[model samples]
Target: MTDGPTHYPPPGAPLPEEPEPPRAMTGGTRPPGPPAGGPPPPPTPWAPYAPQGGGGPAPQPGYLLGAAHKPGAFPLRPLTLGMIYDGAFRLIRFNPKATVGAAVLVTAVAMAIPIVITAVLTFTVGLAIDASGDVESEISTADAAGLVAAYGSLLLSIVLAQIGVIFVTGMVAHVARAAAVGRRMSLGEAWAATHGKRWRLLGLTLLINTVFLVLFVVYVVLWVLVVVVSPGPWPIVAWGLITVPAMICLSAWLWTRLYYLPVPPLMLEDVGVFGALGRSWTLTSRQFWRTFGIGLLTVIIGSIAGSMLSSPASFIGQIAAFALPEYAALLLVLTQAFALVVQNAFYAPFLAAVSSVQYLDLRMRKEAFDVELLREAGIVS
Candidate 1:
């Protein structure tokens, strides 16, 4: 072929162009087509090779490099116990003005109204009782009637206070729910959410209290029967040995199963009293132990915190009493009230947050609430 295109070109001549190789063998290997033995392997779609160790795809960077993902107010995944507690505190921290401020305002108003009413009634009744000036041994019918009226007024005040508690709890539940969905609420907005639901919450509270009261009465009757009607010391001892522990266990169980659980669905879902109760019962059915454990832990923590705060407040109150001996009683009452308000400021939101988080967690376990929340937030398709 013309001396095979000259093994070497003349020293000054431009290098001759090399002939093109076959297209199939261009890269020093034949282009892939059919397997050697079998019909062409089913056409395999091109795909990137997996990383060597078979791990998941690399994680995406967050808003800041190396930062953990923050989907919303909380992580967009099922929560752990620690996460629940953390979320509770975070809810308060995220909107302390709404959560803590509202609690303080509501509690102050609630407590103040009842205190004023009771004080007025007590003052009026005391004046009447002193004016009568009845002998101690022979009490007049008017004095007895006045005493009954005073006691009735006290009972009414207590009921009103309980209703106020229900209202405050409903308001806090609304705030907690809003916080869960990454929304900040104002006190007015929370109040609006709770406005129509107050009566229902109060009814639920009354119903639960009535049930507990009935149970307590029955227990007391049983104890009386065991102690008085039974023939011997052995029966009383046996009753004490068995019923005391049993009642303690029962009370603990009831507290864990029912307390604060219905409030979330009641306020969030706009469910009625009985419906909320049913919802709570259903949600807690299979998760009793977990719920109980979490409730116990939260109560312990709250108790410890309350003790820590209240102790200092009590000490300060004692010091105030000593400093202002002439107004010792007044100072003691004012300081105690101040301390109570402060304690409620922290505890109320904390308890509400715990209840709201627990409600979300239960829904997540049973109904994949995290997915629903993500979908609602437009984080997932």
Candidate 2:
């Protein structure tokens, strides 16, 4: 493992700002071929992709990143489904602080806006609905506005949650990429790297949401056409049975192809939103089933696992509510929030890990990536 007293830059030092020729994986530069019996470290997740640097005896940009170091989590070569799963777990276990800890922080912050908004509305509006449905309170303008504000907050929370997922996935992806190279990112480094690309990632998130919305609008139009043309129980049933399932399939296909693994490219390559989109789409080509299978299974497993963890809290919350009915509303809100937090603590990071690993795996398989001069790049110790 030792590169012969190579005097590798000690681990934990600041990564060099100037581009190492081999470290830049995007230019006319050719990487020194793969190390004997090993793959190269992946391209550093943080690099300037704005323009190619020129030659003046100084190094140029664009090099193959190697995953060749004794993998902190996963090997650099093409990976199997089980290996990807194993690597995600290994990453969480080996780098708990950056993985689980960062996940917790992101979840809490993201949830905070909704939680606080709900709490204020609940206390101020005083639980607008009566569980028994016996109240006949007359409506007031203030109450109506409060109701609108409450629902608006709910909608805002949904948007925030999606943004949170994207942000945290990118953050965890940054750490996971480093781990793939036998390195762990400190919390500070993770934030610095991920936050630097926040606006670009946010723009991507917005674009993705808009795409899904367009799909929804299409589905609605088709449904309207079916209803107007056929207007029968059978036609309705056919729409439900055929149209719905087809739409679901389309969404799944699009998820795996278009937006699933763009974070690493956005971070590793100096691309704007559209560039990352195209890069991710290209990387996932011809591996549709493999990527889809892995992603679908991961989501299913994460859901089951999250439910198992969250169930206990919910059950206990119900029990507590029965024991103290006076505080039922407050108790229910807290319980739901806690359950969500519990679920996200593990699921979000796991998904992000799979994403980062797969991104590198694809690079190795499709682009022939290999790391040659990691020490010279100022990060191999």
- lDDT winner: 2
Tens-digit lDDT track for model 1 on 1-381?
264532333223444455543343244644567757877644433334557788734432332321121344556566789888888888788778667787666556544543454345334433122223321213356445544554454445445544555666677677666665567777778788887777788788888888889989999998887777888899899889998999989987787677659998898885798899888888898899888888888888877886787678778867765664433333444455556567777776777778778888898888787677756655456
Angstrom error of the Cα, residue 232, model 1: value is 2.4
Per-model C-alpha lDDT, please? 0.66, 0.71
TM-score of each: 0.71, 0.71
Model 2, span 150-179: residue lDDT tens? 556545654666577777777777777777
Model 1 C-alpha lDDT versus the unseen true structure: 0.66
Q: What range of 10 consecutive residues in model 2 has the weakest lDDT sum?
A: 59-68
What is the lDDT, from 0 to 100, of the residue 196 in candidate 1?
75
Query: Residue 280 of model 2: what lDDT?
Result: 87
Query: Candidate 1 has what TM-score?
Result: 0.71
**Clashing pairs for predicted structure model 1, backbone only:** none
